[model samples]
Target: MFVQEIAPLAGSLGLSALVAVLPLATVLVLLGVVRMKAHHAALLGLLVALVVAIAVYGMPIGQAISSGFQGAAFGLFPIMWIVVNALWIYRITVRTGHFDVLRRSFGKVSDDPRMQALLIAFCFGALMEALAGFGAPVAISSVMLVALGFTPVRAAVVSLVANTAPVAFGAMGTPVVTLAQVSGIPLNTVSAIVGRQTPILAVFVPLLLVIIVDGRRGVRETWQPALVCGLTFGVVQFAASNFVSAQLADIGAALAGAAALVLMPATRKPAREEVRAAVLTGVATEQLERPEDRGEVLRAYLPYLLIIVIFSIGQIPPVKKLLDAATWNFHWPGLHVAGSSGKPVSGNTFSLPFLNTGGTLVLIAGILTVLALHVSARDAVREWGATIHELRFAILTVAGVLALAYVMNLSGQTTTIGYLIAGAGAGLAFLSPLLGWFGVAVSGSDTSANALFGALQVTAAHQAGLSAELLASSNSSGGVLGKMISPQNLSIACAAAMLPGEEGTLLRKVLPWSLGLLLLMCLIVVGQSTILSGMLP
Candidate 1:
């Protein structure tokens, strides 16, 4: 078997590291600078990775190709599978006209645009993130914002920004779970550290959403409610992830935030008659015109409610054991090359827990949704087909990026890059989050980001005399910010907004927020490594 070499550029660490970054740089330049479509950029990035694996790393051509196929297969299963089913559930609601009732119900809570944004984009979006989370929150929430009369660009931006805080625990805490598994860290420790980090961001995200929605005036008017919502979310997120099951962290936080919003007294100052008249003439009229059918509203929300129930049930120890008992575990074919450490490189076996996976739970939710909504099987089939068609580009983008990541890992390119970064010593704390940001920006999933950088973060922390749990969790927390800028997520948001070629526009809108939050995460992580080291669980 061919062995992987960490420093393949004439055994030079710096040279090998530089070469290792080429695929990532190619993707960033093509998507961010050249404004290429995400699928095309991903394809080109994968090609670069393949070439580097063979030429630079001396990976066998057959092994490299097999690695790509393996990654692609994984992407299609648990990742794309969750996305497709979640969107299909959404399509069922839209087709049954129940989604309008849900929108109207939210509209009833607050007519102010800023308040509406807080409810839909921040609160409800977090709920979706908790439940489905593979671009589903951005996809569904952006469209819902538009239906509430937001401009498509604004809708996309709000959804993307709001998606950040809940992501580490999203998809029933998949990112943290992945971090625990990959880094050999205790799951609760990872969850608790992430809890500490992301909850801090949760406290500010609603305020950020208001600023994006209605500018300074929005914050000026809605600061009280925004503070209430953010604090509630942050506190509950911290408590639940630390004290309760990490798997239910986002669900608990989301419920608390939404409840806080609903229970808090309306703090919106009344507008003058003239200003109110002008607002009414615009989208406010559409908002005011929505009919409220309590039953219809309940039905509109039933799918999501059922999703929470089903997912929570699946998380129970006995149920999980039963469901996972039939898992399929096997080593991948043609990927048995050894790494520089003289161990098998990419032939680790994966266990496919078909029934217990989040994707399967989501699919079950969709089936329950069809039954509850009384949707005809024929119509359900059509909607499922449509959902798949709409996600065709996203499927390609996710698969290609995953393939690139696997090849980098198998060829030892990732190890070279990791070692170079870890050489920063104490300074690595500040750069840790950026590493995660880069990972999620490329792979488009916080779970994928954790898989890519989680172990690396732990190794770096050990070398730097820092807290491994802190840095590993930081990888996940920092990755949440990158979601707003991820090309795959951007494409999904754009598609949901029905703006096919506006990916660049959406990226430009969200880039500043992404960087700003990422910087905040860096500071938090740096503090955790030094002055705030005791804060780690």
Candidate 2:
């Protein structure tokens, strides 16, 4: 039987931890500094992890390889599965011209540009994150802002900042799901903890967006709607994630935030010169006409509504039990490994959630959406194919990243780092979020960061006498802030804003926001671990 040892190099935890960091370091340096392609960097990191697992950690070579395969399977099945179907659902909307209808509806929310930032950047961006994360929200929202007459740099910057609040629940809750899967925590527990943490940011991001869009003048005049949107989003996100389904958290918050704006007190429009200054393209914000028919707006919104309704119904006890009955659970072959307790580690087993998996639920939602939207069967198939094609490289990166994670984890590399970091005792609570933030900054994905460090957070939390759920959820909450600074995201946002080769400018603009928010999240997590413990679920 293969066994894991926290410190296998001269029995020194520090030295082993130092060695264990190589695979992660390899991935980060290549992505962040070398600017290597993501898939290539991920594969190289997997190679480093395998070498460390077998040579440094003394793991069995066969089991190491087997462990990597197991992780790749999980990545492909549930993680990427959820992302693909969610994107497919979005593509179906795009293919049928409903997305433009929805876009115009948002663009016409208010004549003032500040309200548009709240609606499009904060609210609609959250909806995009919920459906097709991994930088799609930043790209789409930034481009939409430019289309609506905002400066390209401002569009990219505010979109990056506003995209932070919903990231923990992005891509149909894949990031939190990955955190739960890797940490051995229950999905609901992770979701509930994250729901509490990120919503705090939700209450502030709308305000930040208004300030960015129009400076002090924007806030002075538009703070009412910003407060209403942010407050509604925060409350609904908290309620839905805790009491309702985590998968529907962002969707609920997005719709609620938008509704709050629609029902809010009216505000005066910006001056023409102000619009011209922001737009620079000479396009007037009020020129884009809203759809005249309320019926069309209802149709544009039905797919998201259908998702919430269907997923919520699936959460009913009887239906949940029936759906879960089809899941397959089995121990993985060629992956027998013992933890510190001298018992087989349970993570070596794999679960196939079948009808209960997020992918399946989203598939059900997509089918309903196709019917309601009147998308032809042929076009639906085409959208699915287009989604697979678009996500091909992303699929490779995710699978490789997961393989790297499992190799590091199963061979004790992560445990070594965990034990080392746990040496900080209570201080680990304050430092935990930085680990996730740094990971995401380099890797450009909250899901990837969670996969790499979720188990480590749990291990460190146990050793540091902190709550595993707190640190685990803190990882994601902190990582959301890092999304703005990720090189990949900067590139995507710049390209979308038509600010090609201006990534440096965009990076400088958003870096402070990312760091400032990260500090806030760090403080929040520290408090949650101590005096603010009541905040947790």
Candidate 3:
């Protein structure tokens, strides 16, 4: 068994932390500053992590290789699987031309660019995040924004930014569940704590998206809708997570946000210049003028409605239990790694939840979408093939970064860095969230981030006399902001936006928001540990 060592480099915590960070730093700087293609950066980052694990951390080569493959398998099967099928649903709509009609329906609601963004990126994106997270919201929402006439890059940025508000409870509260399990906190307590935390982000993210999409002019014209959307989302999420169920939190918030916007005073149509820009972008801008036929409108909306209905049914306790039974679990071959306490890491055992995953559920939705949209079976098959082909590099990028994360994690590189940060003691209240942010920035998964550091957060909190449950739950809250800049997410958004090689551009654009919000979460955590103790469950 390979035992983790938190201070392996010459038995020095500070020195080990610096060396431990090289692989992650290599990834971020190469992807963000050097403007490297995401797959290339990710693979190179994996290579660096491999060397660090063996040379510095003393992880055996056999277990190291096995761990890398295990992570790569996890990424491709359940994670990217969700994205592929979700995009296929989008492509099926495109095949029927219903996607354009859906776009026009948004124009019918409010052709104001700002309002369109509020609906698609924030409201709709939150709904998607609720049902099927693991990159599904980014992939589908970014493409929907493009169809709504936002620039490709802007759509990507908007989708990435909009994703943060609902993520702590994403995938039916997977991240929070993972955190509670790892941290030894009660699920309700962790859920309640994160419920209080992420809603704060929910209140501000819509305003931030407006600022990103339209600057001051957009905010000036549409701040009312943005604020309404954000407020409703935040309020509903808080209620659902604390009072109802964390699994239903984002679903409730998203539906409420959408309803609030629809009920708001209608805004004006897109301006002449906006129409011209849409035309230049090949948007068939004239369709906005078409009088909506009732049946056509229903057909235009059928696919998404179908997705909601199917996912909701799948979430029923009995149905979910059945699906859960179909999953398989096994220890990864030739890999055994224990933490400093000599317990085996849960991550080293792989669970293949083929039936329970959102990916399979999305596939069911795609099949139904094919029938509802009247898409030919032949065409649907072709689109699925095309989806796989289109996301080849994105698939590689996801797998590579996940492998890098696993290599770092199983080898102790990640814990070394976590220990260095946790060493901050009472200042840990101020710095607690960074461990999660760093984990997510590396793995592109808040769920994975919690799995990596949730227990560590609780352990550190105990040592520092802080609230263990609060700090543990805060790991997930802080990790949400990192989603925008995660290399895997960057690749997924770029792929869906059809800006395949622009991951670096997208990273540079979203990095400021990610860091800025992470700082805000840090302060919130510190306050919760002291003055804001009433906020805790």
Please report the candidate that would top lDDT against the real structure: 2
lDDT of each candidate versus the true structure: 0.82, 0.87, 0.80
Tens digits of lDDT, candidate 2, 1-537: 887898899989989999999999999989988999999999999999999999998998899999999989988988889888888988887787777777777766666777777888888899889877888899888877877777788889989999899999998888998899888899899999998889989888988888787888778877888888999999999998898877889989998998888787653354466654653442434346644577777887888777777778888999999999999999998989999778888777999999887788888989998998888899898899999999999999999999999998889899889888898999888888898999899889999999999999999999888898999989998999899989889999988888889989988988888888888899999899889899987
Backbone clash count, each prediction separately: 0, 0, 0
Tens digit of per-residue lDDT, candidate 3, span 67-184: 8998788668776787688777777777777877776776567766677778888887887787667788898778777776677888899899998989888866767866765465
lDDT of 1 by residue, 1-537 (tens): 878787879889899989988987887789767879878988898899999999999889998999888777777776677768877888899899887778777766765667778888888898888876878888878877777667788888999999999999887676786677556688899999999999999989999988887778767877888999999999999998998767678888888998888777763444345433433233322455656777887899999888878877876789989998978988887777786778774245555778877778888989999999999999999999999998898789878877777777777777778777778888988988988898788768887778667766876787677777888888999999999988778889999988898988999999999999999999999998889888887
TM-score of 2: 0.96
> C-alpha displacement of 451 in model 2, angstroms?
0.6
Leading candidate by TM-score: 2
Ranking by TM-score: 2, 1, 3
- Candidate 3 local distance difference test against the native: 0.80
